[model samples]
Target: QNTTSFGLTPCPKWNPNGTTIAGNSSGLKGNDTSSLDRPIGIFVDVSDNNALYVADHENSRLMKFNRSQHQDQGEAIVPSGIISAESVFLDREKSIYVAGGGKVMKVIVSGVGETILDGETEGEIGFHELSMTLYGIVVDSNDSLYISDGSYHRVVKWEKNSTNGTLIAGVTGEYGDDSTHLDFPHGIYVDFDYDALYVADINNNRIQRFHPIGNLTGETVAGGNGHGNGLGQF
Candidate 1:
């Protein structure tokens, strides 16, 4: 079920109709020299959408691949900064932000090295009591970050250059179907135009929206009936 394809308009020799050029029905690791295991996160380069970055989770590395070429697998970049990255977001400045291990880091691609959240010693507060698992991250127009704290069942927001984060939605230690609660929340998005935040309330099988200014509580926008592979159900 995992394969790589190309555009039909290109009309390459190997695949005239643009079918899968890599991976196979056998489900085997396509390449011996370079392969992926538990590829968890993918992000298209901000400068070029054709270039991709994959968080090779199990392999403990990040990869870069150019879609137009036949590079069976990606080239590993920033091999040591992350232990297990759950999400990646590229800002307008082309800096990469990674979320994992209850810490969000900034990795500058231009050899500036990695910078983690500053603690009190650096003259700012930090995440002393962060959730066990972190997933999904999005940076808003103002360079603020919103992260989905999976283990704690809540969404947290960290402002630009701020050491600590504020709970934007859901109550910590509480998980339920109620408007103010979240269960296994993942993949958060911020609509700057509306000043609203949307969360994929995974375990609750619904999507919820919270307004930062007026309402910190989330209201279900989709799914609530139950967990099922039916219409309107996540």
Candidate 2:
């Protein structure tokens, strides 16, 4: 059986901070325009003990919850400002970053959502594809974003304060052949310690990695062909 609860700190909410789990207990109601029915996840605000934020993707909004304060204090930080968000990241300064619609956008705590990076959104970059859809997004300590262009079969880096993106992975025009190129790149995670990147190459049914500076790339740290519903098994 599946059991869940919304509270200051609850089970299966992933990580628990000093206080609340950071979720909205208010169920859907009549005339509720915002898409609160499907909440993705709750993000904690490190600045304040009681402050927590939830990504209401369908509603295209981000709202904050403060445990010390009553439900009345709940407020939408960025309202109706996102479209089909797949992943979200919160920086140390409480800045919320969202990746969707083949682009990554930033919403400062002041409530302004601006298209920060996108090859198709801004001027054409090194390789622009109107069909490329972005999956996972992550920002390095340098504030540069790493994204997977699924349609192009590779990954690229969108440096901070630059409209142009340099190709970090070869657009080999194939998916999961295990050759000298990538296939259907999906999710990406930056390994700061080793200056490397891990990617979920979906179509290839595996995960791969590349050095931060490139030229030193490798194959799935865990070997599998995308058979299991969870992590790959040897």
TM-score of each: 0.78, 0.66
In the predicted model 2, the residue pairs found to clash are 8-20, 8-21, 176-204
lDDT of 1 by residue, 56-90 (tens): 65565566777667666666565644556667777
Alpha-carbon RMSD, each predicted model: 7.2, 7.5
Alpha-carbon local distance difference test for all models: 0.68, 0.61
Model 1, residue pairs in steric clash: none
How do the residues 164-187 of candidate 2 rate in per-residue lDDT, one tens digit apiece? 666776453445455447776767
Candidate 2 Cα lDDT to native: 0.61
The CA-based lDDT of model 1 is what?
Answer: 0.68
Best by lDDT: 1
